[model samples]
Target: MELVFATHNRNKFKEIEAMLPDHISLLSLDDIGCTEDIAETADTIDGNAILKAEYVRHRYGYNCFADDTGLEVDALAGAPGVYSARYAGDQKDDKANVAKLLEQLKDKESRKAHFKTVIALNLKNNENLFTGICEGKIIEERRGEKGFGYDPVFVPNGYDRTFAEMEMKEKAEISHRGKAFKALIDYLSK
Candidate 1:
């Protein structure tokens, strides 16, 4: 009744852990004897997620999962699909990535975009993949001071505040990760 979340981000682990039921104990790379920094070079979220899940499950022999997310903009034709994390350059700084995104869309008008999250689950004897998307638009300026990543600049559909402006519970109720995790839980139940 335990699973490993094949990611290095403590924040993401916490978020996912919050959604998991008590019967399912969620562990991470730190829990195993692994510390290697694997490269996420896959062109799509699904590919990258599978890579991580398979890698961790192969090495640790545990029912594990990995999640990869991307921000796709209709106007930019998904300029930073796979490279969303390192959009600015080699440094995966969140602020730098946001700055680069804002600069690129400064003069553009169509700010429509969507945040997509893909989760790849690998059991010792089976595999599963799930995807979820949250539609939103990029604002000209950043708003609020909560949340992380693209939360400050991207406002969800039918809302005036950015993800950063919403409480953690609020965001969890209507976030790309939330949607994807909900789908994953549903799949697990069946």
Candidate 2:
């Protein structure tokens, strides 16, 4: 089956594409000629995912899935949740976002945080939502050179290394996006 994954990020598209079964043909937003940025005006991660998915399904008439992820910090009162992408500014600078987050938690003792991913699938005129979460904490400084966004400083629970430290295959096995995509894959397989 042919399906579109509505996203402009090549990294995200590649990560999820690698996890799909051989029977499925996954197409990125670029492949589907969706060059315009779909506005993420929703107040929550799931909402944003839904918006993106619906946009493509309605405009491009393609069965597609879209995902939105956030880094919610306990000390920030769940802040930067829906605003994870543009946390530092409208430019969506990853380094700036991490720097700002670290500065905000400088005086706080609790560095608790969690990554949440919400995927919205529109297939055969039906909508499905899947969510996954990874509980972890933000380190004082960046660690590995892999991964993207806040992966450099965010460490998953029970692991000393951040997501950036792990290889693509390894990170996909335990990441929030990974878990959510796994559920999506299972549904598609059935």
The numbered model that scores best in lDDT is 2
Off by over 4 Å in 1: none
Give per-residue CA lDDT, model 1, range 1-190, as digits (tens): 8888888888788888888877778888888867987679788989999999999888779888899999999889997888898899887898999999999998899999999999998987588888889999999888999888889999999999999899877888889989999888887777
Whole-model lDDT for model 2 versus the true structure? 0.95
> What does each candidate score in C-alpha RMSD?
1.0, 0.6
Clashes of each: 0, 0
Q: Could you give candidate 2's per-residue lDDT for residues 1-190 as a string of tens digits?
A: 9999999998898899889899999999999888999999999999999999999999999999999999999999997899999999999999999999999999999999999999999986799999999999999999999889999999999999999999999999999999999999999888
lDDT of each: 0.88, 0.95
Tell me the spans in candidate 2 whose CA falls farther than 4 Å from its real position: none
* TM-score for predicted model 1 compared with the true structure: 0.96
- Listed in order, each prediction's TM-score against the native is 0.96, 0.99
